[model samples]
Target chain A: MTDRPKTIDEIDTPAVLIDLDRAEKNIARAQAAADAAGVKLRPHIKTHKLPFFAKKQVETGAAGITCQKIGEAEVMADAGLTDIFLPYNILGRQKLERLKALHGRVTLSVTADSATTIEGLAGTFRDAAHPLKVLIECDTGGGRCGVQSKEEALALARQIDAAPGLFFGGLMTFPAPGKAAQAEAWLAATRDLLAANGLACETITSGGTPDMWRKPEGQVVTEYRPGTYIYMDRYQIAKGAATLDDCAATVLATVVSRPTATRAILDAGSKALTSDTLGLPDYAELVGEAGARVIGLSEEHGKVELPAASRLKVGDRVRVLPDHICPVINLYDQVYLISGDRVVDILPVAARGKLT
Target chain B: MTDRPKTIDEIDTPAVLIDLDRAEKNIARAQAAADAAGVKLRPHIKTHKLPFFAKKQVETGAAGITCQKIGEAEVMADAGLTDIFLPYNILGRQKLERLKALHGRVTLSVTADSATTIEGLAGTFRDAAHPLKVLIECDTGGGRCGVQSKEEALALARQIDAAPGLFFGGLMTFPAPGKAAQAEAWLAATRDLLAANGLACETITSGGTPDMWRKPEGQVVTEYRPGTYIYMDRYQIAKGAATLDDCAATVLATVVSRPTATRAILDAGSKALTSDTLGLPDYAELVGEAGARVIGLSEEHGKVELPAASRLKVGDRVRVLPDHICPVINLYDQVYLISGDRVVDILPVAARGKLT
Candidate 1:
């Protein structure tokens, strides 16, 4: 096999490329912020699933890792990292079986918002040697999942404590910016409600890159789990979660065809950067170049509309910051690591495309 | 290590499942259609990207395979496949070198839409021991890529013939239904122009799933390259390209959470099925169910607005035919191959995430 290569042109087009210097800087900055805020940092590993990067976070005083599924948790456990949390509701017989088994290999935890979900998890682990610990997920106001109100959350937490073979660990929410303050208010109310019911709510976790910076001010948040801060995508930049210079990952692509004077095509399209349209608002600043909107995306072509002032020529290489970085990373097998002017290593996205 | 799982419920959620029985039927139907139309069938491998599927197509009488990138073509060639065509403009020094190397391993051909691209390929393959084949790609009005007029296409074809290590193959286009006649006109004019220039215009390949059934009368298309036929998707069903029963690939997702009476969430989202919203007339659609619209999608959660009369419940496994199949396949590491009610094998998406 070939060794690591240098320069953007040296890497193949449509491959994921990460700036190690930028990545390390972003990690250090986030860790410092969490330390100053006096909250435990549990960085989400859904952005960059490489075990090498995960190890870096663990070495940097992170409380634990947040994964999206049991499959991802299994991959991380195989890499010898413990203290894993699946922030999604564990459902179905197969998933429950997998979750029950995961408890034996590591310090595994999960989230739930309904009685049916809690009952399902309890039933799966009822006869097991270990009880399954879980967090009661609150909507706080993302409106995607979780219980809607403090009263609802408190009821769920008490029910979890009452269930056999299950332990109520804490509360978790994927709070949006608009609801961060509301979630903070609800978290306080839920804590008081739990205290009145003689229940202990020690851990209150709030997540989402958009509202990550506000966790310190929330007062009720004991831990923060932000995914996009590690890579800093276009959407996160638009949401003011991170700066353009803080973006660690970029799509290194080549100009394959300039079909017209105004329209040029890149080898990377939805299959490379994805058809993620969430981060188009901050396109001008992220690329360090002017006047191009990703107007359309075919499977293998990204049709970028060039402005009259833009002077890009055919066969020139370009860098694109996708709207969403996680799915973009899932689209490539390997990512080239760059430091200054030299290539350091080529990291395999070990968990790339492990959707199941 | 695990053998083929028996039931969809036995496997994890958000898995890509292929009905092999349906897939074989779909392939045979497409082959019969091409045979009846008296055109050579060279199926495009962009949809599956698996060597196993490509080999199946060849076994079922496909003339060759069509790819969009040299990387994908190289994967196919490594599997002992012989003939291949990359239907995209080959530009830049790095890509040209890879393309020249690929030509050494297989019967390789590429598409060219401009003089610059043709010249680049010519310069790279000039000293090749074997001749390099070229196809002048014409825009039949998809407005994506290709030359706008027959005169421009012929001029480029003549220029390719004049250059070293170049042989004019014929013409290619990705035209829609109403534009097939326009492409046929361009193909006729370009064929005459190439003949007038004393060049043999052997094979005119024009195709897309939408226009596959509407081959124009007396058109110059001697061959067709229709992808998306092996795994017909929701987009194909909507565009009259293929019916829902003809769809071979479906996302096996479990209803992980029922947040509301009106809204239910599935484990599969853009990460599993992808945001490839192509060929579908609208944003999203429900595969086997009616009036189910995918309202929003996060990384791992697909929020669906349930129809008033729908009966979907929590933990129910639903099969969703993705709006587009190519990007969906790129989002998974393996696909469960099922025949009738039994899973035959778990085929690795061998070239999965090979965006480069």
Candidate 2:
């Protein structure tokens, strides 16, 4: 505590550096895209896991903040963030109790892809004065959690509508990247099916950072949730959603060893940069170091493969653009918020490790 | 805090469960192995990251504990750990200052693979009353940080011996798994080379959980620093180090959504279980559910591919054996110490997220 770093250079190695100016531009850019599409922007806090950024997104015209877990939402709610949408099928009695308690403190909404999840939600909120908004999660194209078909989504929507102390808050789907048309069509058909069944679909939400800027021509999506847009990563850049300059967060590491002419070891590794390749060839891209990439990572050391002409040496500091920003942020307790080369503030990742 | 779980069944989802009985057995088994081999067991705390477990290992006859970073060692030192070995090429002035302060508090030894790291350490401890023990890290086929050759190791050893306020403490290498003979040969050759140069190498150390049980016939390694043995994971099982019954840590997750007949989504995902494949085909192997494997992971959900005959359903709890336990333990703040089905205590991961 006595030797807390002030400037970026003074901060310790393997620290997460959030470029404040770049992050502000990214936030404004995302909000502008959502506003232009006439869809509400609900930036997911799972990326930063910091209430400060979540508040910033909300201040930048985000309708609300989306959290992947109820624990994250609880942290946000503690920081006075209202209107949190947890688009996850939360189970278990312990979490439901927490969810119910959190529901009392904020305008909370959750998603369900199965009847069992809805049942648990209804059972917990049965005696509540306000009905819990439950959205039916649709698969669309992402083959993860969600109802397989629109009929299943409708059935879950009906289940939510009929259940005690539950409100059917339309549909939500984490669609596959670059498959927006198929997702829009599937969601629109589901919306029509619900409409024909005499159930009004109030809000249809679809989200993914890769497809955030690609507005649906069908105008079926009422809200958008983009988690990684605030701190664009190398994966986001590879996906063409952002450029390297748009990347707001980077790992600052020191070259501890140049064991080989072609290899330089960094103090940061999987523990600092994370081993999330995200389908990329390496762990991260070295900023300003052409042809130099983090090829391998042990828990505490990153193996950077330098180009033949590269002059990287021991004691040299380098900034790295991680493959994914969300998990990388989750690895740190606090991130150095820097404006250019000077660190303005240190933000604690309050919602980090909120798995449940 | 009011609803703290008393039992494993009552505990919340996405929680790390450390089987106390199995962990005890693991500690005793590793200690006995080291005792039989006539080598000092310096268990690496990077696996468990808990001082309680580190103390358990030391109490069970470990010589000391090894930490990957100074920050981790600082946590262990603050927890009253006396002798600490940090097998990392620590660079930067801030970390060196912390290292010097930590050296003042405990018996600290660190490794350096290059002249730059050695220079930093020497510069920091130039006027200290007690000289700092510095080991030359040798590349024993691990392909990570270390001097490339025995000649280089001798050069660094001489440099450390000549440097003021620094003691040339033997050699250390994090060898590649299944290359024990090669690593031993390399370390022994370096030891001979140092002895020929009038430098008495005191302690030679080499470690990796995968090759922990394999005794070096050359007897060059005087101390063994094997992490991950405290809580054997699936990777250890695959490496033939331990069986499933020997695994002490398991992630307890709930089946939040059974959207498809073959796919069940668990509350635990990469954020809880981690995405470290370790060359394994899947994220994790399901406990007691044969043929079921965690196929994919999102930030908050794990997509488990269930066997056709499996009767897993939503709201049902499932235990998962992570591929790698070290990083998995880093993801949580605390883990439930369980004795059979009962939760004995909640051990805080005190050294977690100590990236610096």
Candidate 3:
């Protein structure tokens, strides 16, 4: 508390502040883990949309950047990042056209699990100068968007290989936590199936921050994509990804109302900290407080219920480590990067509303 | 499905579409209800941040507009809104200075529930050319952010009246659903206390869409501020404020993947349809699908688990009515105003992300 920064007092209420030192350390630690595992680290830029951090990940030995949409890849490409991986099933005519335009700029790759998605990508890029790389997204206990069985994956891979302009990249899956073994089994079984069918398996990318450090070793999965590890949150802490200190981003909010002795209101609410509690009781981890729970959120008011003896008053600023950092970052247009409370830099959330 | 507009196919996936006809009906119904109840309808523009809608409200018998933040008010003023009420306690050196500047441009009043907040406002406007109106935020039964009792409210009102550059505006409260009686009693008791102290209660503002139709029928409350009534949400519909057909805004998303016979994935997720479920099980009301629930949200994917017999497939576009509309609108940069299925106009969410 003694080493106060002048900028801390000037920061407005309901602002986002990132600790650069902690973020850099998190990035380096994830990179080292991927290096030791001998897996290519394709850091997901969906968490931190700033090009400054995207370039930082590449400079720290990341193979490329991973984004969920072509819009995000376009932002990264505009910032001069060459390699981009979109690990989602992109459809619709406008999106495919935009994806084609993005392919003209960078080393682009996408993931798909269905014939409709494969046909869409092939139709858009069939006559392009370069054959587009498409990965088969496999269902590995996540039960989300991926092919169900090894036979289904092999069928998709053969179709992709036979396509005029699409290259069967490999297998990709976002495994549920504690299912890395299942992901490895699924990918290895599919890779074997592809090899038996004389189809080339180029890269196997499996990812999730919960089991990020425990990616199955050997040649089963070649690359790992982890987004939330860059700025861990309460959800990550609960998932045992990192300690609370490993969390780099926090919301700076002021207690605007002390309605009662046990209840205070913060300027930040669902609009700032996001209401995705990740199954936690509190919307966020109230920094430097004991037994303070953000109980509810209206559009603009965060209701924090405290203990009877709590002395939190109006105009007092407190930092909140959001329960889920990705959506919270999506709420703000820009975030202030701080080094020990001294504002270091402010970066625009480039891919913030690029939801399409 | 036969009446589908030609423009429906052109809208990108995960786009917000405002049914202009439905929105107009909702706005007219709320305004007529306020007029019937003999209260001023000062519509809160936090839900639809577009200037076009705010102007529409004012033109349709609204006394003024209510916004939560000074940033939102600044945008409204830029759009030629002359009178604005910010019913949240603003804090910090930067915000108070901004509030003082806003007071110079328009008829501005704010709500306060603490002495510290009052002092901050008093200090900022101590010698200004105009006296700032300060309303005592009273806690009826919501218990979120307001003075706990009539005594505490009167104390704050007296403090505001005694301050050099502050005027006691009246009382304000965001009462809990079906607590209009409680709000009426609280405001009545506070008004009696203020009258005994020879103070004027100019405008008593009570707000909440849950009991908008039953705003306490008395001269005790002069103004009603219901933000969500303009574009009712699923929560409001459940509270009997409006029907499902009364909902104006909906997210249009394409089913990009059907991983299993019972599992479907939409392009909208937490980033498109917010994770603030408003205590609902699903993040949003899945339109046109019986027994379909938005079971899970991962940044770019909304997993909708339906019945085994359901025939949902990829490339099928569906509409999602969010559980809450205000924060959902805040997430987008602009909205497409549609008449039937054709886009009539495109409005910028001008005050989107002005969460200072």
Candidate 4:
């Protein structure tokens, strides 16, 4: 503890820094939005992957956290987050055994799109004291995963209801950006179909940071999961969900080389900032450095295309707002939490690299 | 130790698997090529970032290991690697202090492309007993980090030679693919310029995996550093450097869902395989699936485009050859070293996230 840095300037380059004030405000704002919409806000821990932030979200009136994997949920559970929703198809024997162990410790719910995945889950939780809550993941035009049609969703829900140690909870979806209305319409129709089949659909979960602020006017979605609003990125700004000032997380880097008049290199590269352009023009936007863009990245060097009259010199520090912040946060083992140039804390991203 | 996985089938999904036999063959082949070309092979450890594999490379006749950051070099030095070359412009006071400490522990050398970077290195190593070796990094058409012209190289070499506790080692370049000959010619001219200026150029290093097997007929380069030869990837295959059988690293993922007739979802995603397309067609190539390709990736799901009538089921495991192997390797904490169907060893990626 004695060796800890006292200020942001004392920290090393290529480090992820979270503005504590901005992050807290972001958390409170998202919670308020969900409250006003009368929907439970389930903040995805994938954005920060830190228990500190997850607990803050929960304390700020979030219903529960949303995790994409059992490993992430396990981390949150160990940190005393009792409720979690894993919106993924849990498959295979090894993962199912772990899921069962995790289910015993937390009030866990999961989503499945196929009967094979449901069978695996049902076999694992068949003799548990409490039934595992399983949701039918519907492909509401996202086309990534989930059952294709309303008939398919009904079939999976029926399978879950008939399983030995499983209960059909509801329906879940990860809709594409700008397709929330279509996804809500599909989910509503499917809920009706399930009702006609005598299966009670208790919950409807829909999520995406791009559409986080859009209210569910159809009144179909009961829960919303938004991960990146805690630390909005260039992609979120491009989608009009946030502004540059709302971005709380940035990669602090030093100009290691000024190779040419219009080219400068930073210590942070794909390993630090990540290479997820999310269809953006550049890898990242250099904060306060107008016309300078991270054009390319090697494993450890960020090549910046500078303006002709750029004053960026070697040894000068700069902050970069990555195009996508979720994957960037996953790249680091720990991040610095700062407040107005003071280093407040250093939190380890405990759930990072939990690929299982 | 009793809980160790005995075979590949028992290991969890979304795991990085290193084929021991293929990796060893790749190592031996690269070393033999360097030997045939009469140049020292300094393998960059950024590809694997594991001391076990770095030691294996050293045992296979590599002159030294090249690290992109001082943190990575520190990890390798702790593991008893003596000679490490870091080919990045080392900047900032904090990093310089770490570089000074690392220099005291091992035969450490670094690269510089500007006077500011050189000044910091000289200020840190001024009173040391031994002079630090500093190489001038030339752009050589890479357009990344490095001096743009041969004259800039000479100026930096002169500065290094004149500075206290510093020695001008030579020239280094990470050339663009298919531009090796042009880079070599530029280095040859730079070496001639240094010689005419009474500065002795001891070593000239140039490296890239795309042109690993190509010989330097100009006889100017004395060393070569290739990072990706150990785990050849789809990018290497696209460059005609290696075949699919030569690939040593693959992400073993389980097919979690077949959402549509032409789409299947795997457990591995950008968090495991990374989003580095490297100008390739897809995220990864499924090892044995003829027409299956990884089309898109979320954080925890790989949306694989499957061929019609595909047999990939919900529980079947598949191996994926990523487009770029270096960044993908950095995403995992440990990799299973496998020989045929047996899990031989589980090695921690000790330097995977050493961003600074």
Candidate 5:
């Protein structure tokens, strides 16, 4: 795929362009933050979904890679990633069979909170060569997935221990930023409960890119997974996770139409930059331009309400830092890796659109 | 993809289910509306990028197909479609070279709004064996892309007429809903201006799914392209473009977690139903559940705030009708075609992520 060109200027529009220098710096910065916190770094592959970046993270001292879906884990395994932690409560027989196959291919561990999911896992991996490891997902403050309280966490851990062909690895939670202490306390209490039940948990995982730098000082967790730290987005910048200089990926688009004096349309829209505002009013912020902003999108056209002082015109190429790059990266098959106007590589989003 | 299940109940979670009955009705109903208006129907493939549906539209008496991008047109041509209209201002050398190659394969016509685009088309096809038909996109009331006024359309038409390898085929516009008269008046005025300049235009195309049933009478538009009418969504329901029963696609997701009695988390998130609100507050609306709403998405989990009387529980399979189905369709590689409780067929979204 890198055979397209050697220079960035020759490439087409509506492309996911990553600045390698900024990506490398972002990776190192995240690694250093993890080192300071004394936690094993297992970067989430949901951000890039490319094995090239996953391999780079492993080479940079990452313990393993994190995946959100079975299809993504399958792709990473095909790419020779030996270890993977899937932080998703995979269910149903159709998916469990795929999960079992992936587990056989790699050192796979998955998270679950419900008995139905655990039962499905136990049924699928019954009498396997190696028992599948299961982690209980604890609900700290995100309110999305996980056990609600320490009691629920302990009950689920006991269920995993009793289930056939299953190993109770540990507990994990995706806590909201600023609630690290609360989450750590809950995990610690849950660990105490598990010990009271005559069971010991080996690993405790904590995640969330926003809380990556400030892991609970007590080190209640053994490892951390932060997916969006590789290509920091506007959401990360707004949340004080990373600054604008730390963002690595930008969608390169061309202004195809200028309907009015103060209005222009770009070829990239919700399909390119994504519709995940991450609670922002707009899709993305204009890179290298002040006062100009992307107002809206209609499927394929991004409507830009240009500032009166802006000099953007039709046929002009612009870089837009998306509010969220994970979904945006999943929208394209290939991304151009650039370094100082030179296209260094074009990596395939190998696990893109792995919805099921 | 359907090999995993024998019935709809046994199918996987987070899967796209298309009701074949509703889809067939949508196709026939749209064609009947076009027949009543006495215009050629060229449905846009941007909504359902599957060549199967494109072939269905043509089988139901569609004049041709309209694609938003050249990559879509290429995919349609590969499926043995003879005619395609790309209603986009395609620019850059790489795309133009691909367009030239595609033009040789099918009867391809594209729309242009600027001199830069016209120059690119003319230069690419100057020494070709056949001339390419070009349409001048006029800005009627939809101020996204096109010539702003009648004068600009005439000037671009004149340039198309003067170009060696380009033929000024006609005029086209994607206007605001309920503004067909305004668009017609502007296009009629432009056609008169072109006639006065000794240029004859063959086709006058108007588009928009919202205004499909109400194309301005008296044959102002020779052809119409409506994409969303094939699979109506919540946005269309709110816009009076479709009824609740008109929607054909529904995302089947399992309740993965229940954080509280009043809250439920679905396996389908932004990646399943899409993060696109289309100006709505939530991402998707529950199909049969009256009070349930998809409040937020965190990439893999759709946070649903349940009403007090909601009967949703963990492992319950729910159908979510997205606010917009186009981007949601692009999120999955295969969609299950179902009729009642039977799994009829499986179709791949052939042109799902052709971003180039």
Candidate 6:
């Protein structure tokens, strides 16, 4: 994507604008690393969720896509991509019916940690021609969702094996940095246990942008699912995971209204950048240098605290690196794909705000 | 809307839910207060952009609706709302064109501060059948949008008066606490100026949930537009603007995984509750009774620092009051309308994520 020459007037204050060049480069770099590592790269589409971005990722060589919910998968599936993996527990009749319908339309894979989740999926897909491909989610140390222990993971895998409409597709874990090694160890042990039990956990999928770069080489993971790498956020940049140049997505906001000497407000606020400060230290900062701290954010007003020496004025255009790229993208209806100031194309955030 | 008795087993976690009784009561209360004051109560639909919510507000005696953007107004207009006020300085040809088109469908009123905004509106509606209803937006105290001084507001109002296709509607301000008196003073001066200039400032709309009840009786403002009053947030509750029972919306999240002795995690994170901590005090004490704070929040997990004597277990459901209710509501596709323990209906956030 080319950056269109965005005048201060052209772009909306506090809008998420994507640098097509950086996005393509980021995608290429991630794909190259996954290729070098000899693993299937299933880039998480939760970051962008735009059909155009998904198409770009697929064009650059991706195994499939990964989403957290049915809403996201539905958007991606509608975009013509057939294979998708929702690596989260899908419960409830509404979600299960949607999942079953999706499975009939496309190749769908899901993850489960509890028997209830498996039973829910089993009930929905019991009579379907295609079995629901499921990966037993492991708590490789993130402690969010997954079986806590290797034995527990194996037990769940066995349960999945016994289930009539479920296929034990793989093992998936969203690991934290300190626990990545432990997660890999647990995966290795679980893989060995599955082998000893004469059942194969073919695809070992592990991911999380924080643990993406430090992915264990000799781990049991056959596939890597990393989101946020496509648009490296403030958190990723602050954690030294990606460089400023690697940051693909930014809130192209203009200084809409400046009222005070010390404070300059941007059109973007919690609504634009969102309140997703996961790995990020601040709301958002200057792209290349430390310029401002988000002092406060109302629904539509982002109070930017600028240094005395900073050269920013009302109506000046600035690129804001969102704390978390996913939710920020989710808040906007459309994003401008810029290369060098020129907006080459505007793409809708199709799966944006789709929290079902 | 009634509460639906769906558990973590039934519905996916981290979804936004609306308590119908609370919501309807909130609407009725705001409307009643405004009615007693003899002011047209046009509640801001930005808090819950769902058509169902808007319909309920109208049914409960709200005069019209208020929105921040033309995109939102378009959504409301499409849902059969014939009267809408966009209380933001809408700049740009595309937005202006949409605004003009919407003027054809509904009674549209917009705000403007600079000559540029008024000029844009004038250009857009130059060929329209009726003059564009223009409000001279004044910055009473909350230095977000609007002109700074009453003199500046008068000058802008005069500019609107001279414009080909613009009519001076009234004065509008998004006031803070200390600024209410100042806003009233400004509105009085501006109203006098408009009357002297042979222009009728029919509707003097001033709003802020914190200062909603602090309006000077029978004085300057003719109308009030309060968005958060419909769905009081944690911030409003903390600020004594609302009570917990008055909070109409909350995220129905499950305790998906309990990770530590001191900390318990919820499925709702920044994606659900959002990073809008303006109303929240400390991270660790967010919604926790005294002492416990939200220690950390990842994209999908909210890490809570629990009280030592507390016994929060895995799979327990907790209602989290978002610091900012508007964006949190926008993040979900549907809001479960809860009455008690049963969900009467699921209201789609129809105008959700419309950040155009």
* Model 5 error, position A62 (Å): 1.6
Candidate 2 chain B TM?
0.99
Q: What is the fnat value (0 to 1) for candidate 6? A: 0.31
Candidate 4 residue lDDT tens string, A124-165: 999998999999999899988888899999898999999989
Q: Work out the TM-score per prediction.
A: 0.94, 0.99, 0.97, 0.99, 0.95, 0.82
DockQ, candidate 5, comes to: 0.62
Candidate 4 chain A has its poorest 10 consecutive residues by lDDT at A1-10
* Shift of residue A324 alpha carbon in model 5, Å: 0.3
TM-score for chain A, prediction 2: 0.98
Q: Write the per-residue lDDT of candidate 1 for residues B1-356, one digit (tens) a residue.
A: 23357866577778888999888888888888888889988999888889998999999989999988777888899998899988888876667888888899899988888887888988998899998999988877776778877778778988988888999898888875557878788788878877887877888998787778875589589888988889988778777888878888988888777777777788887888676677454335566778777767788888788876678877787887778887888887789898765777888777666665
Clashing pairs in 1: none
Candidates sorted by DockQ, descending order?
A: 2, 4, 5, 3, 1, 6
lDDT of 3 by residue, A1-356 (tens): 01223576677768788999999999999999999898999999888998999999999999999999878898899999999999999898888988888899899999998999999999998999999999999888988899999999988998899899999999899998778998898889889988999987889998888898884756698999999999999989898888989999999999988877888889998888888887877787588888887888887888998999998878888998888898999998889899996888778899899977
Candidate 1 Cα deviation (angstroms), residue B47: 1.3
- Tell me the lDDT of model 2 at A240: 96
TM-score of chain A of each: 0.94, 0.98, 0.97, 0.98, 0.96, 0.94
True-vs-predicted CA distance for residue B291, candidate 3, Å: 2.8
Cα lDDT over the full model 4: 0.92
Q: Is the docking of candidate 2 incorrect, acceptable, medium or high quality?
A: high
- Give the range of the ten consecutive residues with the poorest summed lDDT in model 1 chain B: B278-287
| Alpha carbon lDDT at B273, candidate 4 | 89
Worst 10 residues of 3 chain A by lDDT: A1-10
Q: Give one digit per residue, the lDDT tens place, for model 5 in B237-268.
A: 98899998989999999988877887889989
Residues B1-356, model 2: lDDT tens digits: 33778888888888999999999999999999999989999999999999999899999999999998887898999888999999888777778888899889999998988888888888999998899999989888889989999999988998999999899999999999899889999999999989999998888998988888987786899999999999999999999999999999999999888877888888888899888888898999899999999999887889999877789998899899999999999999999999999999998999999987
Better of 4 and 5 by DockQ: 4
Task: Give each candidate's interface RMSD in Å.
Answer: 1.8, 1.2, 3.8, 1.6, 2.0, 4.5
Error of 2 at B91 (Å): 1.8
* Candidate 1 chain A worst ten-residue window by lDDT: A277-286
